[model samples]
Target: MLQLHPEQIAQRLDQLTELSVELGRGAAAGMLHGGDITPLLERIVLVAKDMTGADGGTLYRPSADGRSLEFHISINDSLGLRQGASAGVAIGVPGVALWQDDGAPNLGSVAAYAAHRRVSVNIDDVYQSGDFNFSGMRAFDGHYGYRSTSFLTVPMSDHEGELIGVLQLINAQDRETGLVKAFSATDQRFIEALAAQAAVALTNQLLLRQLEQLLESLVNLINIGIDEKSPYTGRHCQFVPELTMMLADAVHATTHGPMADFQLSENERKQLWLAGLLHDCGKITTPVHVVDKATKLETIYDRIHLVDTRFEVLLRDAEIAALKAQLASPAQADEITLALREQQALLREERDFLRHANIGGEGMSPADQERVRHIAQRRWTGPDGAERDFLDANELENLTIRFGTLTDAERKIINNHISVSIRMLEALPWPKHLQKVPEYAGGHHERMDGKGYPRGLTREQMSVPARLMAIADIFEALTACDRPYKKGKSLSESLRILGHFSLNGHIDPDLFDVFIRSKVYLAFAHKHMQPDQVDAVDEAAIPGYVP
Candidate 1:
């Protein structure tokens, strides 16, 4: 045994007191910062090891079932043990102290004693029990190689008087002889303070976990709602993410390009993908009626049917006039019959011409052109039996429509959807990576030559991603088999049209070239374009578009 001076003892006590103060301060700081509890608990072990002069220590918390206490954190010789070791609540020496009460193997003994007394337990001897008989003491004693004369266990409780955890200290040094001895009352008090601080930190950590979970659930629900709104646009939310990732990957692989700043790390790539998926989330605000509109005359109430009804009235009037003329001049019936027949034939031709013109997908032919003129020139009697013009002269001569799906006004509203998309996206509280989504998605209709509607941004003003989306949108529309307005264009025809746009500066010439050369257009065509249309393209005849 080695003797220590009074000054040395005081110094040792001061060090132990300082350890408690530092542990409490650190735990409080961590709680304030919303940090995890594991670090605080580990700090407790570190302080315990330093103060008590032990090689290691473990912190235990009760499991959900409350049947056993589990090791929440452990510090062993500057090395931490992995969570959930085989040391059960009742298998180790610490567990014996944690589970014991009144010198016997009472399962609820430790909990009852702590609750009833509201005080910590300090066991100075394990081999010889003075008042507690822990059943697992022998197993605990053997595993730790403890010929211990003294041990201390402290119950840590929160301000609400809830048991947070337990702290155990082993082998205190004897003051008189400098020999190992059981932990004293002072040691118990020191550990109790540390345990209290740990409790506060743990509570704060649990609260943070709950908040994070709530946020995640909310984001997921919003994403699901965005994905389910459109029938034809189903899987679009998912596809955008995939395509964006692919583009990002390609950009990263390039050694020289304008995309150098856009090179993304793994996490940044994931964020980009997420942003792409949510880019059109604002489309939820768009009217579903407009989204599904398949024709120029489509609206909440169609007016094209009214035009058809008017044509039918003209046909009826022509027949009625023919009958009236024949009945009124029965003596001149042969001349009248021949004249009525010719007039009836002319009216029939005019009605047929109007019908075909209204349908409008076929290319205009000479016969169709002449028929249009005849319909425009034809006259009829009004409901009041007065002569009236069927169509105005200028309307008859200037009605050169190439498509039947959308009128000039309806097309403007449809094109203005991109602006609606922008406004809708601007309303969202997007993360940094997704901040550009509104810009990219809203510019899908913009052309390179500043002819596109809404912003009419020229090529330099738009992003490459926006350009890609524009091309994809056009290509999809051209070859889609499901549109009600027109037959799907053949792949050859679609590519030729895309090439024409590329030549005219409506689309990115380089990207269009890349799309063809990389066979990406063909791949998209195969997947979404009609199979018969896909077969129409001659690969050999198609010009190389990509450098």
Candidate 2:
């Protein structure tokens, strides 16, 4: 046996204390940079193992039961051991420590003490423990080929003084004799300090994880609300983000004159994607009835239906006149009844023609135009004998070729949602990375030409990323299968229209062509469009549009 002066022993203990303190400080600094538990645990184990000069060590955290501690981190001489090979705080050699409660036990007497105390115990010499009486002790030594005779154990507790777990060290080397020896009193003290630091680090990490989970759950709830509001727009709020990311990736791949300077880093790209996802979050404020309007006669004052009902009343009046004339028994009465019936039928026919004409979106033909004027000019009388006008000049003009169900004011209100979106996003104190969300999300409806609402920003004013989103929004709406008002256009038809927009300077022509040529739209269609609802565009229909 080697002997050392008391002063030398004291100096070694101080050095061990300093090392433990340094490790704790390092872990504390790391925790401030967004604490992640796994990495923190790994670092704690490596540093502790190196300082103690142990063959190996494992850190155990208390299970929910608090009676048993599960391994949280394990470091061997070189690498980690398989997790389940040694588990259960009371079923292995490691179990002795958790079963003994009193003052620390040496290797020679730990087994007997562990059985007696039912709390943590450490063993320094397995061969000399003749009085120790643990049934699993011999089996544990045999299984791991035990040759060393040293151990250290410490309890882990939170700031509240609640026991969190235990730290165990095995087979520490004797500095002078170069032989395995039982863990010194200093080793035990050092471990106790390290365990305290670990408890604080772990607590912080758990709290952060809980907060992240809460944020994810909230975002999902918002998405569910969006899905529930409109039957025809299922998952639009979710799909927009995915499409935006794909387009952003494409832009990164092919750099052009202006696009070359506007490259987004990986983090910036992620922010753009989040912006797209939350772009329509303001749509929650819009009325679902307006979004799903199927006919021009949609408002509370649906004038077209009023016109049809007036025509029905005219028909009934004609019938009454005919019966009266028949009862007169005069030859002049028969001519008057026939003329009234013919006039009533003509008015009914004219009303029907106008109703169908308002729904026509295929660009009104010459005959359709003339029928509109004739219907507007016709008049009928009410039940009170008050003269009723079916259509005023202004109403007639608007009803002639209905482009959409909403009135101009209603359309403006809906378009104004982009500004609403911007305001809502800006109100939130978003991370700096996501600060551009308001701009990118609010500009999805803007056109390259100075014709879009809210701001009417032209090509130079809008970001390339914003332009990509605009294209995506229009393309998705045109090909959407679930909208109530119109059947989804075929892909070829949609592409032809997109091409027209490109020529008219509403969209970027080069980007549109590139998207088609790369078949990027095909990928997006496959992912978002219904299986039977998607098809390839015919290049011929897209005149001069080469992709």
Provide backbone clash counts, one per model. Answer: 9, 10
The count of residue-pair clashes in candidate 1 stands at 9
Return the top candidate by TM-score. 2
Best by lDDT: 2
Give Cα-based local distance difference scores for all models.
Answer: 0.60, 0.65
Between which residue pairs do clashes occur in model 1?
103-131, 103-132, 103-133, 104-133, 124-150, 150-182, 296-405, 513-545, 513-546
Q: Candidate 1: list runs displaced more than 4 Å.
A: 1-230, 233-241, 254-262, 266-291, 331-348, 362-400, 429-433, 490-492, 513-519, 522-530, 536-544
Measured with C-alpha atoms, the lDDT of residue 120 in candidate 2 is 50
Writing each residue's lDDT as its tens digit, candidate 2 over 217-331 gives: 7666666676788756546676777777777777677655434555767656755776777777777777876666665555444467777777787687778877787778677
Which residue segments of model 2 deviate by more than 4 Å?
1-40, 60-72, 78-140, 147-168, 174-178, 181-205, 252-266, 300-306, 332-341, 358-378, 381-385, 391-401, 449-451, 457-464, 508-514, 538-546
Q: TM-scores across all candidates?
A: 0.59, 0.74
303-351 per-residue lDDT for model 1 (tens digits): 4465566677876776787778879977887887787678767766665
lDDT of 2: 0.65
State the RMSD for candidate 2: 6.7
